[model samples]
Target: MSGSLRKGLYVLSFGGIAALLVLVLWRRELYLPLSLLMIGLVMLPFFIRFERRRLRAEELLLVAMLGAIAAVSRVPFAALPSVQPVSFVVIMAALVFGAETGFLVGSIAAVASNLMLGQGPWTPWQMFSWGMIGFTAGLLRHTRFMASRWGRAAFGFGWGFLFGWIMNLWSLLGFYDRLSWPAFASVYAASFYFDLAHALSNVFFLTLFSGIWLNILGRVKQKYGLLENGRAG
Candidate 1:
């Protein structure tokens, strides 16, 4: 991505997120619309970038396959709270494919899995959170920091907490009228363990499986030249 465009996305994402939080705090009744707005603001750019490309069927198939695998990976772990391999899969995809593909895979995984798991107001939030996870991983894929397994593990661990915190905002909407510091603290406090499980799970998956996934996906990318020109940023 061009430096200017990347800067624009930074501003758009951060500014939009801040605006959404303020709006949600001001009027909880508009949560649905606000969420939709967020989804558009955060996702539209990447989708537009994708649409401009002349993609082949095989490239499209790879994307679908990755998304399907990500969504399906959540099923067996339904019994565990927030301890799924969805994030792991998304991260691996992003690392191999690039940012735009990563975002697509992440968003698709969320919506597809929710079809079986049940969708609610939280769906958009999951899409946004996971999408951003892939987006960030892809953006940093070339960096020396992310090239290391430990660094990637650290990234997953941080996102584990970050994803939980983002989801907590949706829960806080229910207590809008009674919103207070204590209430906020209580909600997060209650989620601490669950979030820790998520974070640790990311670390575990990244530590044990990242290298293998990277090698496998990397070979496929090289062999077929999928997403060659359009994946960066």
Candidate 2:
């Protein structure tokens, strides 16, 4: 993506999110439409770039496979509330592929997994959260910081809490009228342990598996000449 276009997307996504929150708070009945709008704003740029890239059949299949793997990863840890390998998978995929691919993988995983886990208003929020995690990770993939294992682990750890916080926003919307600082604090406090588990799990996965996954994915990219343009195509 061009620098100008990326900047535009950043503005649109952040501005749209802020507007959506205000609109939702002002008129709760508009939640569904606003939620859809949120997804569109967050996803539009990447999909547009993806379309332009025109990935080959095999490459597309690879994306689908990674997404499916991420979706299924949630099943084994169904009993663990917030602890799951989904985020780790998404992050790893993003680190190997580019941002557009990462976003697609994350969003696909969210929708696909929720089908088995049960969907609700929370689904879109999850899609947004995970998608952003992948997007941001991919964006920072080349950074000196992310080039290190500790940096990758830290990235994963941060997203663990961030993912929970994003999900909590959906729950908060349930009683918008009763929202207060205390209520907000309590809601986050309630999720503290679950979020911590998620963060720690991310660190654990990244510490032990990032190198292996990166090497595997890097080899695939090399062997297939996939993403030769440095982005999915």
Candidate 3:
């Protein structure tokens, strides 16, 4: 079989497996695996064609490192929050590998980690949030803003703030039965300090690290010439 045909078959097989899993697991609410399968389906074409050929050893290593970081960062303490800044890593991957790779990393990492930790309805939300962030980062590639340090910095900060806000909103919306408007308002009002801290931390981290991250990505691109011509491979 031709390489393209093989690649296409691989993608189709992934999709078939995902569909079967979803049909079998729908009643049990195995959302994390279902969501992951969907993400893999979305990213399969890129992985098989573009990313498979162009990904460097360093890039794969980075993906593994980021995934490990995300998995290990989850804390069991109730008082002390688990700082899963998976978005940052996802953005970095997207910037380096392009959108498809970024999506794969973000979605796969979230779902895989959740599976290890324990799956819940929240898993799907997490997957959506991280996946969207990575996809947006990839989409930003075509814009002039991603061409320079300042532009990338701005993109990171903007996305970070947006991610924080959106995730919070998703939580509120998903748990609306347990948290009514008045209760949510009261809780949000009281937790303003925590929310501000989270948002500000994201802003600061993204702003401070975006430039450095961009430089590293530029070096990788220079050395390996991956995704250099914006043609995926």
Candidate 1 stretches greater than 4 Å from native: 1-17, 229-233
Comparison by TM-score, 2 against 3, better one: 2
Model 2, 79-151: lDDT tens per residue? 9888899989999888888777888899999999999999977787888889989999988988998999999
For every model shown, the clashing-pair count is 0, 1, 0
Greater lDDT among 2 and 3 belongs to 2
User: Rank order by TM-score, top first?
Assistant: 2, 1, 3
lDDT tens digits, residue span 109-223, model 3: 7777777777766665566667667777887876787766567656655655555564565345434445466866765665555445444544555667767876787787788
lDDT for every model? 0.88, 0.87, 0.61
* Candidate with maximal TM-score: 2
In candidate 1, position 52 carries an lDDT of 66
Best by lDDT: 1
Per-residue error for 206 in candidate 2, Å, reads: 0.8
TM-score (C-alpha) between model 3 and the true structure? 0.59
Badly placed stretches (over 4 Å) of model 3 are 1-62, 70-84, 115-118, 147-153, 168-174, 177-195, 227-233
Clashes by residue pair, model 3 = none
Q: Give the distance in Å from residue 35's predicted Cα in candidate 2 to where it truly belongs.
A: 2.0
